[model samples]
Structure formats: C-alpha cells, structure tokens
Target: MNDQYELLDSGNGKKLERYGDIILDRPCAQAVWAPRNPGLWETATASFDRVGGLNWEGRSKVSKAWNVEIAGVVMKLSATDFGHIGVFPETRSLWQWIRSALREQAQTKGRELKFLNLFAYSGGATLAAAQAGAQCCHLDASKGMVEWARENAKLNGLQDAPIRWIVDDVIKFLRREVKRGNRYDGILLDPPSFGRGKKGELYKIEDQLMTTLDLVHEVLSEDPAFVLLTSHTPGFSPIVLGNLLRQYHQSGTFECGEMLLTGKPGVNELPNGNWACWINTFS
Candidate 1:
C-alpha cells in the first residue's frame, strides 16, 4: 500500500495539509527554526497557532469530514480538538499489512483468525480486519477516539458492526483478558511514548514495552495470525522494535520488516519518528 505523506510545506512551527479539500493547519515541532517557503503558508485555509490552546484562522467554515485517497484506499479524514488524525494516512501500510497478514495466516492454518487491536485509535486497522472477515476487538484509552472510530465505521456503513470497542488502558485490558482466558489470532499495538493510566499508573514505553509484549504473547493463540507493533517515539528505531520482537520469538520463526516512511514532493526527508514490527507465524 502507498502511504501518502505529502509535506506540502512547513515553517514557523506550523505545517499545512491539503487532504481532500479539508486543508488542515497544524502545529509541527519539526518546522522549528525556519520557514518552509514564502508562498505555501499564505494559502492555508487554517493556521493552528500554538499557544494557550491551539487557535484557528480561516475564512470559510471548513467541514469536519472529508475523503482522502491514500495508498489507493478511500479513507475518511477529520480534525478534532485533540490535534490527532486517528486515521493517519501514513498508517496505510499498517492497514494493508494487517489484512494481508490475517488472510495469509488463515489460509495457512486452515481456520479463521481473530484479530485484536489495542490502543486502536480511530480504527483503521480494525476496519481493515473487519473487512477481511476477521473477528476483531478495538480497544482504546480515549472514549473520543472510539467514537471517531465508530464514525469511520459508520462512514463505511459499518454501523452495528461486529467489532468490539473497549475504553480502557491497553495494558490493563490485556491483563484482564489474559485472566479471562481471552485469546486472539492476531494483535495490533501502537504504544505511546509516555502516558499515565486513568488511575495515576505510569507508563513509560522504554521501561514497560517488553514486559507488555511478554504479557501479550500469553494472549496469542498457538496457531496465530501475527502481532504488529508500531512506535513514533523519537529515539526508537525500526531495529529497536525488531530486536524487541526478536526477544519474544522463542522459536525465531517470524517474518519481520522495517517500516519505510515517505513524504510528498520537495518537502523534506522521511521524518525520523516511527517504527513498526509485523510478525507472522511461518508454519
């Protein structure tokens, strides 16, 4: 799948995006210390000035929903107060990768695959799995994100969908599911750089990811589909993620790869802020 990350222009700590007419003016820390160019900044439909809560400057009332063609898939996009596009186009590979992995796993195992997506922000992966006929569980820590996912599902006319939506910390939820004997054929995880649990529980990816992976393996069935982990932390590399998955692969029998990020025209080099691990059972 073609992950379209078009960097139209950037500068003054702000970036402009033209994703299917819903031009988004977002704050970007990377554009620090300089301006991208002289002209692109002027055409911005909106500029989210970052200070004391982001501010927007635009003429016409912009619609919240729009269709964006990325990697040949027509996924819907929207803006929210949280400053996150849950259905990030850069994640097109993830959606395609999961669906393909599940399909292959099912054919190999001669059985259906149950996919579980933890921290499933916005549900792109969940939607992809559901479309592939995989029983899916979509869990996230943010209720609003779940709602956004639901909207995406509904946009695809997937309302009353079979996918389960759970609002809970991913790690905590997995621990409970393990105790409840709930297992899945596949797992999708995109952990945060840092976060605090709903109950003051601290979560530091550097300190907790491996432990979390150990527990996640307990919830994967013997004949499994795959486990995919992606991170956008500054210091973590694809190798870091690959090595982590390696630690969990007792059999050393898994197909792994690097997540190559891309960008649009004369924009900039690939941003150094993401990593992914896609694991599949060889047998």
Candidate 2:
C-alpha cells in the first residue's frame, strides 16, 4: 500500500506535510519546539492558519480536490476552511489495525463481522473495515462530510460495498441503533472536543463523553471484536482514552498510544492525537 501522506517537518505550532503532489503547512498546536528541517518548509504549496480565524494562503496553487491513497484506502482530499483536509493522516495506523482486527474476528467466528464508525469523517476507518469484509455503518453529523465519504468509497470501487452512509447526530443515531437491537462486533469513534448536532444539539466532550460511551456500550454485540476511540483534543491523553474504555469493558486487552504523523528517515514523528482500544480475546 502506497501512503501518499507524509509529515515532512513540524515545529513552532505548525506542521509541513505532503499529500500526494501537494505540500501544505497547517497549524499544529502541540508542536511548540523548533522545526528540524527549516529549509523544507519553503516548499509548502499552501498554508492555513487561524490568526484572524481560519485562513488559507496560496490556496490557488493546489487543485480543489485530489486523490490520495493511504493505508490501502483511496480518499478525496480538499482543503477546508477549518484547516483540515478531507482526510486525517494520523488515523492511518488505526485503519490498518481495524482491518486486522475485523479480519481476525471474521475468521475466528466463521461469520461476517459488523462494524460501526461514529463521527466518521471522510470514512477512512469505515472503508478499511469494509475492505476487511465487515458490514459497516458510517455516521456523521455533517451531510457534506457524509457525501464526501461516499465519494471516497466510490473512488475505492466500494460504492456497492456493504456500507450504510448516514448523516445524523451521533448520540441520536446510536440510540436508534440500540432501540432497533442493531449491534456491531467492532466500533470506532473520533469525537470532537465540542460541536453542535444536526438539530443544534450541543456536544461537549467533557460533559457528554461518558454518556456517549454508555450508549455505545448498549449498541455493541456480545462477544464483540474491538472498540477503538481516538481524540485530538488537548489534555485528552492516551491514558484518558484508555480509562474511558475501561469503564465499559473489563475482560479485553487494553492498549493506548499517541497517534503520530510519521515521515521518512530523518523527519520527526509528530504526535497528532491519542488513541485507546480494547480487543476481545477469542478462544
């Protein structure tokens, strides 16, 4: 699998990265240190910052949309006002792990596994799970993002795959799934620190994450495969995520780590987020 994403260098609250043929300089709040490859930053085709609230420089240098293959999944990338491209490169490792876990579970159970992804931006994890032969449900609050994910699925020749693309509030959707007795063998979620739902329902991670996890637990099938939770919010460390999952699961093998943006030989690996996962032990 050819990964088209690379973090060339990062420091001084910014990260320089290459996505396919375009190089972008984006804000990285955690990169407080000096950049290692100072000279490499000059190659950035475009840059985004929040100095006066969300701004992009040299945007005309790049196309509006392009394709990038990361972790064997094809994604459509476009620069957004929020300083995010359609895909997040840090989750590449998580996508690979999801594929492996789902494949193992399907083989062991001799049945197709069901997977669910919440707050699924651009459907990278969903596509990975589908590629591993899992029936997937991809949900997000933004209709535009859901459509972008569908486009990505088409880009990967998975338009006809067993994927349920949904645009709804995460909490409301999960509740409906629970009521419908719909359960998944594996679940992946990347919740935002704060956001509004489809009906203007406010979601603050500090206030509602536990409730969200409780609802997620209700929708999980018995003898499940795994649960992966990742976050980019500051102060939400690996241990914080692991502890949150531990509250709902007691028997699984738990692991947590910093999600990194990795590059070639000399480039520094930047910790872009944190992830925690609980994997079931099958006999």
Candidate 3:
C-alpha cells in the first residue's frame, strides 16, 4: 500500500482523499451519512461537484496530472471529468491477496501462473500480477485506457514483462480466447455496471454478469488458483457475487465482503465496493 493515498473524510454524499500530494473531494453515492468533520472539507484542494454533469471546484497547488505508486504499481492520476483520480485505493487488499496467492503457488507448485484481467483499467491488477511473477493478459474496451496502462507499465520498468495489453470487449476477448484454447490459472474482474464496448455493444451488469462468469469458467485452467470478482454497482451485493461464483465453482473457499477504506478525519469505514473471491484448494 502507498502511504501517499489516504481517505481523509467521507460523508454527505462525498469523499475527501489525499492522492500523493494532492487533496481532492469527490462525490460518493454510498456516503449517505452526515459528515462528522465538516471543518476538514474547507481545506480540500479541489472537489468534484455533480451538477448537470460533473465539475471540479476549488483550486489545487498540485498538478492536474501526476503519478503515484500503489502496491509497486505506478499509475498516472488526473482529475478527470468522471470524478476519479485514476487510482482505486480500496483495491490494495485485493492486490495483496493476489500477490500472496501467486507467491505461494510459485513456491509450492513450481510454476509461473497465468492471469487474465477483465476490464483492466490503467493496468493496476495487471502490474500486480506481473510483479508477482504471473504472465497476464489485460483486456479493456477503451483505447485511451489501454494506452494509459501501457504508460504505467513503462513507468514500472515492466516494458519487457509478459503482459499482453488487449483493447477489446471483455466478453468478446474471452470468447476468442476460448476458441484459441487459451486458459489462465488466475482471473481478476472489475466489470462496470453499465458500459459500451468499442463497437457500442451494450453491457448491463444485471443481464450480463452471469453469462460473463460462465465464459470466464470456460477459459480457466484445470488447476485453477484464484478468482477475484468485484463490482461497484449499487444493487450488486457480496451475496450476489458469491452466488455467481458458486454457480460455476461448487467447492472452493468463497469469501465475500464489502471493500472499505477508513477515512482519516472521522475514522469512518467507507464502503467502496463489494467483492467475492475464490481460492481453489481442491485442485
């Protein structure tokens, strides 16, 4: 985990954060509680205000673009129109989990694991897996994001690493991989609730999640290691993710929980998302 990124405060439908040297306040739908430390909000460098669209308020001494290292993965950050600073701090635990699993497998199994990352934005998980000695194929539908991920790879000095940056829809890529007889020992997914493919293919989480999981199961190696699935959709719960995993894998340790980040000012655990992960011990 990087010491630079911190959740300063969260409540009243917004979250205050420290990304490297920058302090930012952004809208958070899950922050339904009243703010405990309203005084700290005044000191924020900038804030994302949701009006007719999204807008940034206040002024920051920090650069509009910068870099930060999280879990040994260097990522570029920007105060985007989408209300994100290009890095998700709550995923620190998940990265650690994947690294530990890969390390253990490398030591005991004596094999370099292969990983597939779906909806791999900016390549954080891809970098983590590669650093853990896993060859990875990163898939996303956005070309700009793929290029940003490439820059991140270069920043980490992993330019020669076995990471395939693929700019394609996750479902389409998975189907193609299946046809090519390619499989992976580990899988990571962070599918958006609603999105459009490069070719304008509609993706609605409620309708496509299960079918996507089924496709994922098809491309998994026989002796699978891990499956980490996460969702930020409001209606999506840990139970839903767990049930989806159970539909494909019957016997594995399935741990389901809400991902949280502790805010500095109020020390409140802000729920960022939900996750369900499986570690296969049977095979």
Candidate 4:
C-alpha cells in the first residue's frame, strides 16, 4: 500500500485516514476498539456527519476530486454524495494478486488472459488486470461509477486498454454471458451487503449471493485461472465463501483469510474484509 493511503487511527466507532495528504474521519462500525490516538481524530481535516443523510464537516484542504496511485496505477478519487470517498483502499491486495497471476501466466505459458470484474468501482481491479496485460470486462450497476472508472482508466493511461465498461445488474449480466457462452479466465466480484440495480432491482447479499455464484459458475472457463470472492458484511465468514467454491469444481486449491490494512504507529492491522479464493491449474 502507498503511504498516501494509510489508516492513521481507528477505533471508537470511527476511523481516521490519509488519502494523498488529506486526512478524513469516517464512521467505521467495525472499529469497536478504543482509539489509540484521540488527538489524531480531533485534528482530522474533515469528518463525515451522518445525521439523516450524510455530510462532511471541519476545515478541508482537499478538493471535490483528487488522485492517488496504487502500484503505479493512478486512480481519481472524489467525495461523492455517498458517504464513501471514491477509491476503496482495502482492495489493493486483490489488485496485486490479479496482476501477479497475469504476469506468472505470461511467463509460464505466454497465454492471453481475460477477466470479468463485477462491481468494479473506479476501475481499481480492472486497471490492475489491464496493466498486467489482460483483457477485462468491468461491470457495475451504476452509470456514474462506470463513468468514474473510465476517468480513472484515462488517468492511468489505459484509456485505450482492452476493457469493456458495462453498466448493468451483475446477475443479469452473468446470465446473459452464460446464454452467449461467454467465458472468462478469471472472475472477481465484491458484492455489497445491500444494493439496488439500475432498474430498481434489489440485491441482498445474504439472500442472493449463492444464486449469483451459481450463475457465475456457468460462465467461468473450463480451465479458469482463478475466482475471487470478497465481502465486508458482518457475520459472513471467509469459510462460507470457501465452501461456495466447492460447487464450482470437484478439486481445486482454496484459500481464505482476512484482508486488512496496516494501521499507523500504534495499530497494526485493521480488518477491512474477508476473502475466499480458488486457483484452478488444470486444463
């Protein structure tokens, strides 16, 4: 992770972070622990105030938009209507894994890889895969997010990369891909706990993820390079995702772990999410 993206302090139902020199304080329900540095929280450049809706407070040096680099890929960040800042720093590990896999495949077999990234916000994983020389299909339900992703791609000099930006519901797209017999070497999806599709289709991960994964299985290549499933929803264990991978194939290596951010001086690791991944080596 870049120094620009750091968890300065986290605790007491909130977290203080630095994004390219701008410090922010935001609500983090997972930070049930006490703060190690209360002074850092008080001096935050801006803080999120979630009253009825959401708003930012305090003196701010940051603009409405900014840029941050991760593994040499530049991403445009912004404080949007949603409480979240545009970029998701927690996904850095997943991006690096995708890049490394592509590089390894190139060295070992010189094979061209294709990836499907669902809910690929701001092109983080999409750019990483493309930067590693893979064709990618980036899917998201939000048109605004897709546009933001395009901007990020351009920022990283990947505007002409082999990336298909699609704005559609994930389940619908996966079903269509199965109908069209479209297959991808790698599949990655970061499902939200609760969300709504373009046409107002509701998605509740707890209720719908298994069915979505079943559909995803239909579109995976016979010799898929990998499948990555990550979630931040409380109570959803990584083992649950590992078990889901069993439905995809008879035998494969599965790994599950927590994706954490190395916090500053006092705090060591701040839990961001949990992940389950499978690697298929046989053709």
Q: Please list the residue runs of candidate 1 whose C-alpha ends up more than 4 Å from where it truly belongs after superposition.
A: 1-5, 11-14, 31-38, 67-76, 198-200, 252-269
Model 3 TM-score (2 dp) = 0.95
CA lDDT of each prediction against the hidden true structure: 0.71, 0.92, 0.85, 0.84
Clashes of each: 0, 0, 0, 0
> 207, model 4: CA deviation in Å?
2.6
Tens digit per residue, CA lDDT, model 2, 189-224: 899999888888899999989889999999989879
| Pairs that clash in candidate 2 | none
Candidate with best TM-score? 2
Better of 1 and 4 by lDDT: 4
Model 1 lDDT tens row, 186-205: 89888888876656567789
Give me the displacement of residue 238 in model 1, in angstroms. 1.5
Model 2 residue runs over 4 Å out of place are none
Where model 3 places Cα greater than 4 Å from the true spot, the runs are 264-266
**Rank ordering of all candidates by TM-score, starting from the highest:** 2, 3, 4, 1
lDDT, candidate 3, residue 250?
84
Weakest 10 consecutive residues of candidate 4 by summed lDDT = 260-269
lDDT of 3 at 261: 76
Evaluated at residue 72, the lDDT of candidate 1 is: 43
